[model samples]
Target: MNTLQKWLGPVLFCTCLGGGLTLGWSATTDLNKKRSSEVAVLQNALYDQECGSCHFAYQPGWLPARSWDKIMTGLKDHFGENATLAAEPQRQLTDWLRVHAADHAQGGKIQKMVRSIPAQATPIRITEIPYFQKEHRKLPLRTWKENPQVRSLSHCATCHPQAKEGSFDEHAVRIPNFGPWKD
Candidate 1:
């Protein structure tokens, strides 16, 4: 074969491979950006009223189904408080939470949270998750205890102003007394 004929095949192959790689990389980058932005917002009125009344109505994507199941069943002693609900509403909320728990949730943030948990662990408190601990590890214990506005780490919305909307982006965080977090 002539030099041009022999070179043509390799040139076309390289061009196709480069183009395919670029497209794949672009799609992956977009997906990751979307996933890192936020989680699904809380939509159920019952969940908001019942859970939000006491504490932040955490988005179901924060925990796994097994964790939700355990929490829902033990409402009488929910974090040292009696949050027992009626049978019908309890069942409904349990089902809803199970369907949207981190294990079954969409987005990379939710998946990342799930991955941080051990396989045998069923964490009832979102604060108990390894991902949650790691994220807040930099904060001093005094931040949670001394800050009256943020009495506990469980109070996510206290610092995360957009937490109710399911956005936990660090840039948007505004600690009660500490101001915006840099890390």
Candidate 2:
């Protein structure tokens, strides 16, 4: 090949490669920034009054939108309780949950939670998550059965006092009768 043709091909290839690298890096940086945002709190008063009345109004960022949709539609059989809501309130809660669901939420915790589950899995409870299970698996059975304060892992606030505020920092964990969580 002629010198001009050979040099031109290499130049074009390098330019395209550099451009691709720059775009990829920019996208990764943006995602990292979103994932590193300060802890987000569930601020919806209506959600607090409606869902929180029965149980901890779980942070929407813990599960995917599909899971929320399934739970919202199946409230009549919600963990064996009649949690049926009026159409209007149901719509509002569903909307709120969908907007803040794990797949859409920003933060490393949310991203990791989302990644831990299969794309098709529709987990109604955070405790059903593999990541959550693995994290809590170290705890003995007594913590769930014998411990009066912690009857179930579903009771997030039992150990994580800041759960209502949407914070689950390991450093903040305090188990009843067991003292602070180590590791």
Candidate 3:
């Protein structure tokens, strides 16, 4: 009985270790493939001129076309700020956002965000996406509300210096008042 117990323990440990290694390798491969490419930054002169002037110019791929439409229609009360653009610029920006929306594009976190959302949901804010929320679940509430540099989750660039380039790789994250993120 003693001999059997000793053998069984090592055998079970070996099996579990092998299984964990296989799963970890496969997960890394899948994640690497999905995030290999970065979404193109917002390059439209009008988009940058109007939106970038106020805050970081979020890439259109962050949300779906319906969300963009909702945002454009509500420009008069845009997050409590009146961001009403002229008729022509509004139309152009709306068209640009739609064409590059998450559902219309491929690659990276944007694709994951699109898949995480339900068909009925039309989230105007990137922070409202399930994937974004899941990624931030480890963060303390004070990190978003009390941290002056990271006053809100909408301040993407506060923690993500490469946010402007549409690169949100976890390896690039640097939380303010804290150190590098560990996942």
Candidate 4:
């Protein structure tokens, strides 16, 4: 009826709406940060022992289930080495890897890695993933070849000190002789 009375209702509604939106935005942003920060750490002891014995026990989230399946099936000639496991352990590792692979991931860098691959592509090597290549494109070939401490990009832990822990944050990288990466 009067100017003050008429304006109060709309003012209160607008204030409540804005406050709700602010809170919602804050919550969403935090969730996204948590998701995007890292992939899941290697949790299977058998995988860690069997794979880590020869190379970095790369988190399964780096590749899709199809890729993991391919890799598991080809362990006899794994990257020019015979990495064949016994029947039981091999089956168990394959199952675990597929379950946690990128395609099945909820969110985070793992999901981004999955999205980078073509739907038809089944890349057995994590280094072959488009996302992995893009992220490492800035590095010179010498870093992987000449650096005694970092002989290959496949050696994720050589630069990503926390790769085992599933933390691939660029800020934490220490590229052996090359030092900290900045890009």
Candidate 5:
């Protein structure tokens, strides 16, 4: 075989292999339209259960819908948390969880922007994100309680523009009490 044939052959083979792997990864990604839509609709119904009933459900696609399924199906024994759900209802929750499972989900806005940071670092919440903390670090925690509407992170939408869209985008940030504070 010619020198060009040998060099091009391995490169093409690797590219195809890499592309196939990437396609497979995307196939398993939790952001698929069908599953995400199902999760979006269920999000509202989740509030009907109880306050903190669905804490952080909309924060990030943290858990792949599948992992969400496992968690809900075993709600009564939910890790260390005291959450619970009925068998039939758990089934419904499971179906939704499968699509929005933590494994496949993006945790929060910080995660979306982590590409610019060190991957070895642990993920952080909206309130814990560096840029976020830097901006709101001056505020007192008690201030939030005194004004229920301002309860610390209750106003996440004040900055994360996508909070209304059921997603978080760092570029959309505009901290509340600073600008466009009204949610």
Candidate 6:
């Protein structure tokens, strides 16, 4: 084939692939939103308990089923904080958490999170995502004045409504009374 024909075929293939990927991400985000809704319902049932109070599960599927198992068993010393959960309650939650943990290979939430994480020596928490940092980086000092809901950095869903959808695009974020985003 001529040079023009060869280039045209390859370019068209790439263009189609790129478009497909973008569409896939959009669909996946929608799925995440739906799944997040279920998890949120589960969260509400645990009103007496505050598992997600300090920490976050931006990508709940990031850890393996076994990881949540380990954490559930040691609630008192949970990663340092006292995440102590009662025995019966823990059993219920442990099963629920494991069920939602990421299991897929390509678009699995847990796999995506693990890949995004740096291979640094330090341990990492899901709350420390770059998007999370960018959103809350300027709030440490001012966080005190905010309402109780927005006080914690884990409340990404409060400001960014699409957070549960995995839409961390800064342009799509709405930071409370701050209005639309600058970035």
Tens-digit lDDT track of model 3 for 33-135: 6444666665788888999999989888788999999999999999999999999999899999999888855656677788899999888888999998998
**Could you tally the backbone clashes for each prediction?**
0, 0, 0, 0, 17, 4
- Alpha carbon lDDT at 63, candidate 4: 84
How high a TM-score does candidate 2 get?
0.77
Q: Write model 4 residue lDDT over 1-183, tens digit each, in one string.
A: 699999999999999999999999999997667656688765788987898887788888788889889988998899899988999999999999888878866666787788999998998888888988999898887877778888888988888888777788999999888888998
Candidate 3 local Cα displacement, residue 38, angstroms: 3.2
Tens-digit lDDT track of model 2 for 66-111: 9999999999999999999999999999999898888865557676
* Model 2 poorest 10 in a row by lDDT: 31-40
Error of 4 at 59 (Å): 0.6
Higher-lDDT candidate among 1 and 2? 1
Clashing pairs in 2: none
- TM accuracy, model 1: 0.78
Q: Write the per-residue lDDT of candidate 5 for residues 1-183, one digit (tens) a residue.
A: 698987998999999999999998888675554344322324546434532444534432433343344445555665466677656665665665455433443334333333322434443333443544554555556445454556656465545666645654345555545543332
> Which ranges of candidate 4 are over 4 A from the true structure?
1-35
lDDT, candidates in the order shown: 0.86, 0.84, 0.85, 0.85, 0.49, 0.57
| TM-score between candidate 5 and the true structure | 0.39
TM-score of each: 0.78, 0.77, 0.77, 0.78, 0.39, 0.48
Q: Report the backbone clash tally of model 5.
A: 17
